[model samples]
Target: MVSRRQLIGAGAALVGAAAWSRTSAMGLPEAPTMDSAATQVPPVPSQGPHYNPVVTLNGWSLPFRMNNGVKEFHLVAEPVEREMGEGMTAYLWGYNGQSPGPTIECVEGDRVRIFVSNKLPEHTTVHWHGMILPCGMDGVTGLTQPPIPSGKTFVYEFDAKKSGTFMYHPHGDEMVQMAMGMMGFFVIHPKDPNFMPVDRDFVFLLSAYDIDPGTYVPRVMEMTDFNLWAINSRVFPDVAPLVVRKDDRVRIRVGNLTMTNHPIHMHGYDFEVTCTDGGWVRPEARWPEVTIDIPVGAMRAYEFDAVYEGDWALHCHKSHHTMNAMGHEIPTFIGMDKTKVAKKIRQVQPDYMPMGTKGMADMAEMSMPLPDNTIPMMTGWGQFGSLEMGGMFTVVKVREGIEKGSYEDPGEYRHPPGTVAYEWTGALPEAPSAPAGSADGSSLRPAGKSASAAQADHSGHE
Candidate 1:
């Protein structure tokens, strides 16, 4: 097998005038850019000490060159068109090609030099999140070093002092750059490969965007009110499934770049959080968790054995995070008949559709026409039926016979007889009713008002 450095060197032909003129002039290595949104299998080191490479969901690892006993990498900051999902494309400023730029992996104690070319409209600097290095290499644009001006290239040399989960993003014009999707994972592997070895490892970042349903660029000024919650910039249905061979020990590392926290939940098995952005946890200090809360600007890594054979759900526990392009102004219409109003609206608009009186499940599955360049607020078709999901949701498929090193989808799981949930249809029995007076609160009124007055006040408030 060819070394990743060799394969990346072949991409020198892809270097444009902006990269070639500056990088070659400075004897810098070529920066390889990715063009796809699919999850890529981790690359193997051709002649180096063995280590388990990580799978980047909807992303890839950055390739590095061995130059004079040092690892050399180049990154280009520029605008890119990213496919957030099947039919949605977002224009974002990122490194190399994709938003939440390619994962950068290195081994502990390795000396590394990274050349960064700025092709964006503004100056930017690469902050090594969670990394310990010289004060000058901290990447704070004004404090540690001057910003890398637009159309210029700068280099940062550092040594990987520790092995753990880390990240990189712009420190100059930080808010706008980050809101426009410019961040990536930086992983430092242990020098001893056998230390905490696992069969498969995966990494992704939690990000949220405020792009309108039909827009191509995000609202850089958005502080809260982010509508699209994503894992590695790709929403559900477009996010690739995590495929695992049954009984294989697996590790998943997640970092939160969003403004808020994410409680990432897994269905099949309980796992222990073995690492964080700081460093590895002591074996005696680790704890089991089914859902791990990844705080803003932090990382959490968990491990579990793939003992269950099924299609299990993995998603952010916050309900809104699993939906897409939602509107905050839509009034709840459950149990309210909007037919007469809808009829009146149809006479003038002819395309008015009433909100579902039952629930959004029925509404989301309807064939309502949506805007161009966007998908429904909540959508996905599973083998069973409508998945009714969108952002920050994906399945973890555990199966019996998957080949090692294969990340390909194994299709839907075939349930054994009597293993699937079925609807009840046999007998109807009388059920217990609500306790007396609990329905209207007549028996629990406060001294300030009578039950009738309280009811009237509640009605008025509604």
Candidate 2:
């Protein structure tokens, strides 16, 4: 965690630095800021009901100070520069120096005091989504409480009444704020330590941005055709993998903040949804699934036993969601003969070339020049070769003998002899042909076994 005062030495806002210094002197809780986007350890809960902390994928947990018996937390809502991928960055509005701000962890029935200091240019309100609280503490701007105006701080005091998956985001001018990436996961664990325990717990928020190719900001008004589908504001190859020990019971919680729905699919396991934003599903009521469709503005949590030792693919089932910038506009050119077209066009421009005639997979392998700050539509490479994937995609690496609580990537998995898929080099036998087709190009009925003839034969026997 980076302190705001430390940033001032590097020539940041001086007045804000003095203000934060005074704010600390005034007995206010510290607003811990995150400077790194890599996965960090969930801080050990100093004092609270015993519960396992969740690992925030590509994010961190906001630390709190215990004031008397209440958990006190200070959050500064301000503008931040978020790295969308390796070479792409977006200026967004978030809390404590990062978008989809730190996960707030609490126990059910705990009295929590959150101090939200508005550093944004406009007034904002922090709405606690999917949590039961006092009407006045609901964080609605006009209906419940006044907005926290720019440069002012407001406090929300409430008891976390339920334990389940929830979220927090700006309710004032939400369309603009949330579109600019103002959101975070809020998890209230069950008071009972035995309840819903898992070996490895992970949480992330699903968000989309319409950052045009080579641009730094998302189009806030654009409702659909979003090009950057992300998990925790980072796209694939950059989004860290979930490393787990073989046979560990894992629980993954996902909140959907995107405008559209996502059918999240994971290979090599059929898991059951154990909880949702509403509440925990009864064990008897749960059913098995390999793909869970998370609806807009909702959350779903699923659990599975990682018994298989391998790297499994986990991504949105929608093909385009697995691609990067401007994925929706590309036209299909499969099997088209563009040789003549390329020859004719190259006469005028000597460097002219045609692509996609064979398929879009060629795009992934091409070294074609791209605009500055733009990531390829389909990217990532695997041990085998080009992965041909992007956006909302990551791998689950399950390995044997991984130490407990270690989340580091274990590198690529080493397949056992005869366990991996290999290309076929054996000779092929005579291919079987379908029984001769009729003049209409439909296959003829099997010899002496037409449906009508069978019915007639049965009638004669009767």
Candidate 3:
């Protein structure tokens, strides 16, 4: 595979000006926003929360300062210790001390001034992944402006004109910085609560890393093979589940920064692709969907009414994305008789044990030793058995009596009797006879000569 650096260096000359015009917001539709505020100290237009804030696990929304009617937020780009899962951490570069950084929340028409202080070992620049802004504020390092040098601070002032789900990340190093987990979600809530009102709103960025076991830092140069897939810099079972009340309208805004696309699949109910980083889709333009594919550097918002009362799964459709610490070069052992060889090898080496003789599903249940501070290739245990899942996997639990805006863990769902899968407990019934023409005494052979004569003729033949 061509390295990202080589692609950037070569593609830069051919797609530079054309790429900016096509990608960096030329004819974006204006985002929709609310027009009124009802419950507040004085009913401020863009003040006080308009809707119930979505909980970002291991992250929070950036608090802004009211500086003479202009909202101000400070983003410090520095090194951070990000927890990918239980017993696993990576040394990554992030904004505001979080791998995914803090969620930047604003309203349409709000004048925002963000101060970004760079403390990294090298220069960097923040790119608004899907925002309509001035060319100078677009944050392309060489095209729009010079890179922000280390130890220096840069300020980006712009009006929050569009209301939708968006993201921010380094546009300077492009490959290295992004691969190191430097990204965050930027949400501009609609000004009109009635426009896109939902009982609950959630946001997270889909990111991937290539951090090997026993290593503290990620390999930022890796572009294709990623061992650690995460949602908001966390893997399961460390990732939190989406909890909602029955009949509640929920919005899940997902942004993808990984090298590949992710078809995010949700079970039990169909949702609508109501919005994107570009803008909100019109009601008539929206369609029901169970899975939405989010491409690299793009964001998608899925909204649906939570009607099912169970623990439904939500994960990346790519099977490999649902695993961790996988070895791409592991030899396949299918159909191989390794039992005898394994026993002989075990006599010499006590730890020798052949695996994958049947399939890899057994790895989920095997109590094998792993490196310290590392997760297994696939690890998630449930009431049934091992979940056999790892990265980019989470559950959406809807119950009957959850408090409004409360995200308390509802625990595992208890299935009703006869609903759970189990072994057969009743007496076995007799199977039916074989069909006609079958070899199980259902058909007869042609008879020509006596059996003894045919046996004697064959016995004398060579």
Per-residue lDDT, model 3, residue 66, is: 52
Summing lDDT over every window of 10 consecutive residues in candidate 2, give the lowest-scoring window.
12-21
Q: Which portions of model 2 miss their true places by more than 4 Å?
A: 1-25, 343-352, 435-462
Lowest-sum lDDT 10-residue window in model 1: 12-21
Question: How far is each candidate from the true structure, as Cα RMSD in Å?
Answer: 6.6, 5.6, 12.1
Query: Which parts of model 1 have CA positions greater than 4 angstroms off?
Result: 1-26, 432-462
The residue-by-residue lDDT of candidate 2 on 1-462, one tens digit each, is 664335434453322333444555577777778877888766446476767899999998877766667887888999998888888888999999899898999999899999999999999999999999989988888999999999999999999898998999988999999999999999999998799989999999999999877788889998987999999999987999999999999999999999999999999999999999999999999989999999999999999999999999999999888888865657878788888989999999877768888777877887777888778888899899999999999999999999998999999999999998888899988877667554655454546687677557767879
lDDT of 3 by residue, 1-462 (tens): 222123234645212333424532532211111111110011112343354455565466655545556666678888877878878878888875578887777787888888888889999999987898999999999999899999988889899888888899999988889888889888888877788888878788899888888887888888788888898888877788888999999999999989999999999999999998779999999989999999988999989998878899999999999999777788889989998999999998999768888888888898798897788888898878899899999999999899985777799998878887689999999977556466643332235766566556756874
Per-residue lDDT tens digits of candidate 1, residues 135-241? 99999989999999999999999999999999999899889999999999999999998888899899999999998877899999998898899999999989999
lDDT: which is higher, 1 or 3? 1
Q: What is the C-alpha lDDT of each candidate?
A: 0.87, 0.87, 0.78
Give the better candidate number (2 or 3) by TM-score: 2
